[model samples]
Target: MKSESLWFIFINASLINNFVLAYFLGICPFLGVSAKMETATKMGGAVTFVMLISSMCAYGIHALLVAVNAPFLQLISYIVVIASTVQLVEMFIKKISPTLFRALGIFLPLITTNCAILGLALFQTNKGYGFIESFVYALGAGAGFTLALVLIAGLREQLEFAEVPNTVKGTALTLLIAGILSLTFMGFSGLGS
Candidate 1:
């Protein structure tokens, strides 16, 4: 990853190895907020913002920990930073768009617990990515997550009027859609290399 081109890094993260579809890191928001395209987009933006901030902070924090020879604290430190970043994003969204804030409900602050953010930090560090590489990776992961959410939302929206069977409705239908979407992403696996 240190020598990988920025384009490759972005494409790999956003599509080939997507945090949601490939790694299944952030299923909570992927399913919860994906009920509507509007909410899904907003959640995607919020998650992306958090990922960007956390990526930068993770880069700095990893360097600082290594410098101090306290690498054991890495996991706890990442959680703390992710929590704080989510708080900042939550407050900012509340101020700029109260409707969205309410619309997101529990899932808004749930970004802190969304494993995709933490996974982004950990994956970049493990891959030995530099600051720029980490940033692009985070951006790609966020983009991929948004893409998955939007796709599911759009499909779920369409399913509403398809007159589906009663037994196959709700979670069953959502999971069925998600499984197909995940397989669809698998077709892009070759592009990462």
Candidate 2:
């Protein structure tokens, strides 16, 4: 809750306490959208955009709720913020690139429910981060989520033609790769300590 430098907050969110690989908060979209590089990257953008908006709005809503002695509305308020942000993203993508839009499918809309965004909101609120700090935290979290998706998508794409045994083909191989990637991210835990 104490003040931390912006870079430290960024590094901590993006690497040390990664919303995906580190905390495993957003596994659904992580696995579902990570199959293709295009969809994965787009999904990451969508998620990041949602996170940033939701975090900012959550910070404001929390302050309002506190001012009115209604902190109990925090959860529902945060959900509304995330849902609204996702809707805007959905409409934007639909008009901008239908191909990418189609590629993302259900997972695109599912950003509304992605726990990583919610977690980021809650974490920032609980930590009592100021507006700028919350913004930077959301940025780092988004970058981290994007990095993880791109890495997994690239690796999975490469593995497609690797000719492995049947037992290690689908989800099995993906999980194996995810485990390794998680460990790889663990290396950054000591980054700013």
Q: What is the C-alpha lDDT profile of model 2 across 1-193, one tens digit per residue?
A: 5669999999999999988998888988888888889878878888888888899899899889999999888999899888888999999999999988888898877888899999999999889899999999999999999999999999999998899998888888888999999999888977967
> What do the candidate models score in CA lDDT, each in turn?
0.92, 0.90
- What's the C-alpha lDDT at position 75 in model 2? 94
Candidate 2 stretches greater than 4 Å from native:
none
TM-score of each: 0.97, 0.97
The regions of model 1 sitting more than 4 angstroms off are none
Query: How well does candidate 1 score on lDDT at residue 102?
Result: 95
TM-score for predicted model 1 compared with the true structure: 0.97
lDDT of 2: 0.90
